[model samples]
Target: MSENRLREDLCFWAKSLFDRGLTGGASGNISVRTEDGGLLVTPTGVSMGRLDPARLSRFDAGGRLISGDPPTKEMPLHAAFYETRQSAGAVVHLHSTHSVALSILPDTDPDNAIPPLTAYAVMRVGKVALLPFYVPGDAAMAEAIRGLAGRRASVLLANHGPVVAAKDLEAAVFAMEELEETAKLALILRGTGARPLEAGQIAQVVRKFEVDWD
Candidate 1:
């Protein structure tokens, strides 16, 4: 896609996430790799609901800001994914409600953030690492992401939200949506003795999808 089209699509999805209440206020950020190997990131303090395509932050392959607004304070978070995940073409971070709530729960598995709820969730999200929390804008969380060595593409920040990396912006958004829905289902089924997919079933899905689960 041309740079113009990439900009427009990125904004469109950001608005989609915002309008669907997956993110609110000025509480989320997105970044996509450009054809030139740089990135176009959502601006600092900008609501995903109201992004201006022309004002998206543009960074060169060397990580220099070449145009538009300065990137979000969590730029380190986005950068870490690109650096660690060779296949990552886009990164999305959102402060969605249910995921945050799930993160705060005492029983959530740190190695696998969302419980197995459905085949689609198991196929798309794989094992999401529930990372340790930090002050907003802290780079420490990015280091945690680095430590994963890109074996996992989704992570839930404790007391915060979800961050997803995928082959493109659209796939990243889809993965994020699936993860949020899994969180919602997990929260609803908590204490109901809900039966998750059997271990063999999960293994089958992982084998079919070649999910990079660790």
Candidate 2:
């Protein structure tokens, strides 16, 4: 896709996320790997609801800002995924409600934030890691992601929200939505001993969809 079109697509999906309350204020960031092997990212302290295509932050393959507004202070979070995951074409981080709420629950699993609640979640988002809370924008968050060594494509920050990476901008957003919805389902079923997908069912879905299971 052309750079102009990629910028437009990013803005379109970003506004969709904002309008649906997936992210509010400047609580999220998005980046897409450009065809030139660079990146077009949302600006720092900007709402996803009102991003400007022309003013999006542009970074060269060397990681230098070549144009547009400055990138987010939480950029290292995006960088960690791009560096570790060779095929990560885009990354989306959102301060989504249910996912963040799930991260705060005492019983939520750290290694797998949400259980195998449904086949769609397993196929689209895979296992969602729940990492310890770090101060927003702390480099430690990036280091923690590095610890995962790119095995996890989605992670929920304790008391924060979720970060998801996929092969492109649209896929990243779709996976983010799946993660959020599954988190909501997990919260709803808390203490119910909810019967998630059986081991065999999960295996079938993973194999059928070729899920990126870590």
Candidate 3:
């Protein structure tokens, strides 16, 4: 798609996320790869609900800022995904409530933070790594993700929220939503003896959907 269209789409979806309460109060960032191998990122401290397409931060393939406002402090996190995941066309990070709550819970799996509570979660988010918390906007968060070596596309930052990378902007947003919802499910079912998809069922979904569950 054209750069203009991508900008519009980015703003549209960012607003959708904010309006739906998936993110709030400038607590999320979105970035998409441009056709020229650059990036158009949401501006620093801008509410996703109120993004202006023309004001999005633009960066060259070499990672130099080309125009628009300064990028978010979380740029390192986004950059790590693009450098590590060859298929990543977009990256989204959100301070959604449920996912953050899940991250704080004791004994949450670091390898797969959210269980296979639903097929959509399995198909969209795969295994979500739960990383230890870092101070918000800390470069160390990026280093932790880089340590994953791109083996996972979704991660929950402990005491913070979730980040997801996908083939494009829309896929990234959808996967992030799936992660949030699955986290909600997990939280709601805690100590309720809720039965998650069994090992075989999860395997079948992963195999059928070709999920990047590693």
How do all models score by TM-score? 0.98, 0.98, 0.98
The per-candidate count of clashes, in order, stands at 0, 0, 0
Candidate 3 residues lying further than 4 Å off, grouped into runs, are: none
CA lDDT, candidate 1, residue 196: 91
The lDDT per prediction is: 0.93, 0.93, 0.94
Q: What are the clashing pairs of model 3?
A: none
Task: State the local distance difference test value for candidate 1.
Answer: 0.93
Candidate 1, residues 120-184: lDDT per residue as tens digits?
Answer: 88888888999988987899988999999988899999998999999999999999999999899
Model 2 regions lying over 4 Å from their true place: none
lDDT of 3 at 163: 96
lDDT of 2 by residue, 1-214 (tens): 9999999999999999999999998889999999989999999999999999999999999999999999988889999999999999999999999999999999888988888999999988998899998999899999999999989999999999999999999999999999999999988988898899988999999999998775
- Kindly report which residue pairs in candidate 1 clash with one another: none
lDDT of 1 at 175: 95
